[model samples]
Target: MAASPDTLARVEELTARRLNRTLLARQHLLARSTQTAHDLIHHLVAVQAQESNAPYISLWTRLEAFEKDDLTALLADRRAVRSSILRGTQHIATDDDYPWLRPTVQPVLDRGRQGAFGRVTAGVDPVELAALARKHLTGQTLTRPALARLLAERWPDVEPLALGWSAQCLLPVVHPPPSGTWGRFGATPFVLAEEWLGRPMAAPDAERLVVRYLAAFGPGSARDVQAWSGLTRLREVLERLPLRRYRTPAGVVLYDLPDAPLADEDAPAPVRLVPEFDNLLLAHADRTRVIADAHRRVVITGAVVRPTFLVDGFVRGMWSMTGAGIVLAPFEAITEAARDALTREAAELLRFAGTEGSVSFTAPGH
Candidate 1:
């Protein structure tokens, strides 16, 4: 029998460059893999999906045979869903996974909701609110405002908007198909996840989840996992895992599954255009692994996650779908040949978005 990955290799030192390549490879960013959208969602745990079409664009950059409908079909087939998961935001999770992952992240969601809308919902019984939300939303899809109005009748004392936002935060609800479908903005209608899927949400399991995160995003510290997941005290979980461990060039300790592969430090990574809120950028607390300090704030300014692209496994520029055309604003200059390659990739990205767009650029230095 093969030795366990934990036992086979002693932990090795990793440089930032080596860490970046390993991250890209595990994330399927080093090369486009041929996995279907459904399989990819499960493997990655969740893909950041705040925008209506961002998940589709993300899959396009990571999968070879990915089609817009491949993800659409997963949603239609109830094989996948978009709901609040990690860090209290929308993510695409498989049908079998969301139930447990949802409950696991509830505290994070609760913390965010309480901070955002809790003052208005003060003294409200969350249990009662969640039950009423389930009752009102079961077997029906309703927008936030409309559902707020319905819920307000029950708690007329509470502000309807607060109630609506609270229901969203507290319940395991999903925005229905047309809402997250590519190139569409159907009313942000929501329904109970349990009712829609004909299955109950499984209980949260932090140990298993931590292990999975290590499998995908690891050789990472507990802080990194918490950054990706928004839960805390994960160092306690990492302490118990039977995995190899390493320290980065910065001397930060990281842990990983015993058998996980570490590519050579100088591994090649192609340029990849990612949509707003891409998990690669959002998942790690120490984002220097993929994004430099100078550009991090601009990439994720308050409530504005500008689109970004990865060149050689690290973020190099911002992009947009402006009316004039597809635009790239690089923070630094690149070779003319590199510019040519970026242009071709941007053109393909435009086509994937179902728009005919000319690629444009904002040269370095204004």
Candidate 2:
């Protein structure tokens, strides 16, 4: 049956409320059958805390009282780890979970190395290169350059930069402190993930991961999952799952866990200031979930994605604060209610930044 547009709109509203709360809410309810956005953000906060400092900031803007060290303590306990996840980018995840997540993402690293790094390390012996890295990094932490130098001696034909990427991407490695150390100063140092985490990377299970994502960010199309994970052929996995499917107004079919709650279409939404690289903006194939296409230019310019604000679940504009104060440029004219909410949100951000920054607004035509 074609999903009703009304049902889709209801789902969007409810999901926006859930996502508007941010990562803290997203992670909390990921494991539960019927989860709220708050619960999901709570869980994301908990998992993000595995890295500690930044995750707290990541949650603070989204949540109510995310302290700086809330996440620090988590990392100190080995409950979480910072490693490459989907799309081969760094994410702080539970140590218990990283083993499984890391291997699942290895294909990205593998593909990148062959397509990009392969040109550089064309003649280099994979076994020998891995051995060189193991030898250099055993019991000692080496920054990307230090590791590069060690390998460069053996594989002079390889570009040092390419060598660094290949080392981290092609092999099972961990970027240890003072890379992620709180307020510490140093470059990224390479160590084996197994050595640092005390366990080997787990085998890949595309199906379970897909299900997990759908549970957290579901009522979404298979393309959304692929967009989030950079994984392809997920349609097969989605089809196998016991999921309830629907179609958006655009006729794109979507899937979600059967009992997952969809946000109320008319739910009152808060103005939210999302951090750079916040998954809310990046989680879907079609971002109509939280943003409009015309406003895309305001948030994304070429490869740079700016911090954005959501008013009534739609991205009204982009924002930035400088010495002058908070500057908001809207792609569309916002209402007085939106302006008031944005003003309040901006003030909160200023307080977080530890200063009283003024606010300014710029409309496109004016």
Candidate 3:
């Protein structure tokens, strides 16, 4: 049975470490899940895919036995899709989730278009542009540049880049396979979502969006949901939902599904090599649960969230793959135990990446 709102109102106060453990459990970072790549993508609602290899690396770290082919096959089979959704950025969502998820987050895309191309698209009919874009993208895929030129032919006065981006934000278009496939890289191409998936998008539902967000990245505040989805005014929506609430040590109210399990604050956390643009680092407004403010500044630099290694469930350093192999750059010195753990995790990452190289470390902050 669901807990009554009255029962839920006696809010529990969650310590920061408690929030950290719960987040790790929900994200499957405390332990790699046995779930398949497709199901994990759906449960996540969307996997950040700004970098072509990001989704692959993200899944590799979270799944028990994930291979590059595990996700590559999904894109090839049309069971997964890559498009702009959460925060108006590139993400790979399951075919079933995209139909509804895209619509739910459409407002964010619309707002992005206005902020980016509203002035450039002045005096241009957005509805007409969207229709024409859909028509061009109906049965065939076109690269962004090609689509831009085509749209410019109709509105000769507008900037081609603006026109292309405007169309992208206005229409539910997707980048087909090879666009987001592992080890693949190139200019992004688009096809109408309906044409690509052979299904129409469902109507937007903010309520469902909130529930999914909490499931994956929860015990979060309204601000966190808004931050993650790039949609605002969620507090009202949150108030109407049947979620249980808790207070942070700072007195901030956090909402979660009534049945959701909270991990014990003392639960052990393994070292993890989180990928760049991974949603785990971007999902919450108050990121201190998973990363310290000082470490965050080093990990996130003006739109780029560098790949990081976690120690004791918190970010301890940044890492990257180089010709020399995996390089670990810690912000501060780590204990010998943490160093040994990171070394082992790094070796596994190399094997998963299918690369031959040695793992090296630099002095703190180097």
Candidate 4:
């Protein structure tokens, strides 16, 4: 006989529970790791920022010995930078990452600006405008309004908001420190990422980026990556990657690195308080792994991503800082033991925040 037509079986299946714990471990949510702030930022690729103090708290919640000074030093020293990239939102990324990250995501920003802001900035040469924007921002830090007003002087006919937002969308800009400092609010300043970091923007390499996404948030589908990054048409990139593929019992294809960690289905998941816009919660197309179907809308609104906590590697509820203390609102009731764990962690968070805050709870569905 020539040969058996049937080949050896392939690819392990990943249950939602296993997926949850694996992701938690990769993100350092199960337990705080000792990775330096710079290394963590580089590994995670970026932290969802723009909300002051979110980045600092994010590091604190994920790094064992994290302190405010750890992150503040990176921003002050320019080893890291804050800028708009994935999904065109403000994020803090290391100098090593942004060069490649910014170029890769430029098309996403272009599409967003063209579809939304371009309607108002119609007929403006974006190429020329980008050049002018870079020129205006070179060796200078200008707030949005100031930069807008200056650019508007030349194109007085265009809406100043459009002109300003165009520069924001089109440029690889950084809002340096004292800007992201907790509780400090004023003019939001911008500088070119290349100038601030002294590294040129890297060429777009979609293949490598797909691998990075897999490393950080993987065993996920292309749609998950698209949902996380807000970049579309990534199927080609995913297809080209040398990925180890798996499927859920439901048959959803999941991709991963050949050696990526996939934890046991029964692994324990500790409670972790994450800041608003935590990328872990935002990284999947099917987030039922980390969030329930009914509770998703409650966590995210139009532009606001609420701070949330994970119980057993899933978003058990939401939390917030109030005048009196940290408030925990569970979507479902928890055991006394879980409640006690949350209370202890809340105190740690309060101390990290330099607050005399206490923990308060509300009934499920309240």
Candidate 5:
């Protein structure tokens, strides 16, 4: 029998909701979904800019019993090194993984160079500059200015800050220890990625890389993958693969592995505190799958997105705990039950932040 238009619309809504929950469940299992936490950690670290500890929480949620020292050990052993990869932001990637992954995201750095630092270092040669960096950083560590001074003998006019960013971003470089240590201090110093990791980075292989991303943050659209990887060429690559497709209410077409699970939109999502630049929030170009459209501004203002509080799979509000306790300010009015759940979540966040009772919210616009 032919279905009515209203029934068809309802069916589509039901499909999308079911798919959403399935997706979440799959990710929840991705850790155990694979072998050990070590295997997952080899690929699970997300990218962040200045915060060294951000990746810790990202893994903590995904894997059971993940300790800070586990990641620190990867760094010390050269199994992973901190550098710019996905989205052209700092990430901790396996040494073996960086070669291809770094080059895959190189275009982002190249584009930035063309935009800002390209003209500044116009006359200078890339090969020559890379050599200079490799030499100075080979046997020792140096801050940006110190390294820039070493280059100044050749390129006298280049800005040290811009030059340093170019070297760190464009090249395989790691900001070595003490920089990432919990209580350590001082300006961060860098080491070459190959030197620290004990091998040269690999060439780009799009198909393999795309498959890995699917495993990590899959069941997404082409744009979502592009946003996560900072590689815009993914549309052509993903289309070539045999992926299942679905239409979202917003008219965007979503793609995913054929066998991946989907979560129910109506599923009860616990109150969870996600860190700044978490893959959950930043991995998608269109975030309606996790965050609602209207409350977007409350989560992200300019370049900074507050680490948010989630209740029932939607962002109900923003949260922070002063010396008093955790405080939550909703973007719009929520139910009494949701408020209680958010308060309980706030307490958990306070516990994570090593604090006591959750604080009360200030009056709006205070």
Candidate 6:
């Protein structure tokens, strides 16, 4: 049960460092988790997987002994799926989560479709388009381009790309395996979430969604939930819930599950090499808890958020793989101890990536 809002009047206050450690602890960055990839995905609710290798790298960084096959097997068995959810981005979520999660975040997808394709599809009836798309997508998978071409059969005057984009946003669809699998990339193929999972989507439950958010990325504000979910007007929802409250140093109200533990601000934080678009950096409205404002600019440019390395539980630099090995690019100078730790982690990452070479560092801002 949740506590009443009246009980939150004397809420605790949290520092940025405390928030950072809490985020790291919940994300399993402080220590690798022994849970299977499937279970980890469930705990996370969903992992940002816009890039093929992103989810693999994400699991590797947080799991005790994750293998590429661990996740591959989940997709192969249909225990998990890749779909556009939460902020209308590609995410790999457990099959159990996709049903309710998709419906919860459907508004984000709907708004995305409208903004991107509404003009081209101005004259098309969304209901008719969705029905036709369902007809084509029910029993089989079709690549976006192929699906667009098919949609064009009925609406020749409308832009094919718009029609396809609309289907993707308007319907609860998912991209099948080898699409989100590691080292594989190609045209995105789509299938109905219901047909693929053999279950219908559940109704949106904002209360459940908020509780899950607090579990994974909590001690956050209403704006944080809205930011992560791409939904608006969540303040009303937050107020009615029985949640423990805390305020940031600057007085921003943050919410968390009543029983969720807060990590000690002085707890030791391990160096981490997270993948591009990892939710850790994007899960909150104010990211300063995990990344500095100056560093955020360099790490996130326009649409791309570069894979970053963490030192003392905060973004210290960006990293990428080279044919030879992993390359680290620090935004500023790092301590000898931090460098040594990063080098050792990089070596382990190389082994996991099945690459051979030495870890190297580039001059700052490279």
Output the number of the lDDT-best candidate. Answer: 6
Question: Cα deviation in Å at residue 337, candidate 2?
Answer: 2.6
Q: Is 1 or 5 the stronger prediction by TM-score?
A: 1
lDDT of 2 by residue, 1-366 (tens): 445676665543334434433322342311122432234343442222223233444555655554445555555655665666666666667666677877887888777678877876889877777777887877777888888988888878778888877888766776664467455545576778788888877789998787778666666777898887877888888888888766654557778778766554555566777655666667787776677776765577774567677776667777877776788777778889888878887887776655566988987533
Error of 6 at 307 (Å): 0.3
Runs off by more than 4 Å, candidate 4: 1-10
Per-residue alpha-carbon lDDT of candidate 4 for residues 265-360, written as tens digits (9 for 90 to 100): 687888889999988878899998899878889998877889998888899999998768899999998989889999999989998888886899
The stretch of ten residues in a row with the least summed lDDT in candidate 6 is 1-10
lDDT of 1 by residue, 1-366 (tens): 223455424546688888898889888889898988888888899988888889998889989978798898889888988888899988999988888899999999999988987888887898999889888887788899999999999889988989988999999998778778887775578889988888998888998889889878878988899999999988888888797778765556788998999988788878888899888888788989899988898788886777898887888898888656688888898668768878998999878777876999898734
Better of 3 and 5 by TM-score: 3
TM-score, structure 4 vs. true: 0.96
Q: Which residues of candidate 3, in runs, are more than 4 Å off?
A: 1-10
Which model, 4 or 6, shows the larger lDDT? 6
Model 3, poorest ten-residue lDDT window? 1-10
- For candidate 2, the TM-score is 0.82
Q: Against the true structure, candidate 6 has what lDDT?
A: 0.92
Colliding residue pairs in candidate 3: none
Candidate 6's C-alpha runs over 4 A off are 1-9
Local distance difference test scores for all models: 0.85, 0.66, 0.91, 0.86, 0.67, 0.92
Candidate 6 lDDT by residue in tens digits, 1-366: 344455444668798999999999999999999999999999998999999999999999999999999999999899999999989999999989999999999989989998988888999999999999999987899999999999999999998989988999999999998888999998999999999999999999999999999998988899999988899988889889998889886767888889999999999999999999999999898999999999999988998999999999999999999898999999889999999999999999999989999999998777
Q: Candidate 3, 183: how far from true, in Å?
A: 2.1
Q: What's the best-to-worst order under lDDT?
A: 6, 3, 4, 1, 5, 2
Candidate 5 local Cα displacement, residue 354, angstroms: 3.8
Scored by Cα lDDT, where does model 4 land?
0.86
lDDT of 5 by residue, 135-195 (tens): 8888777887788778787777877776776677667777877576443556768877777
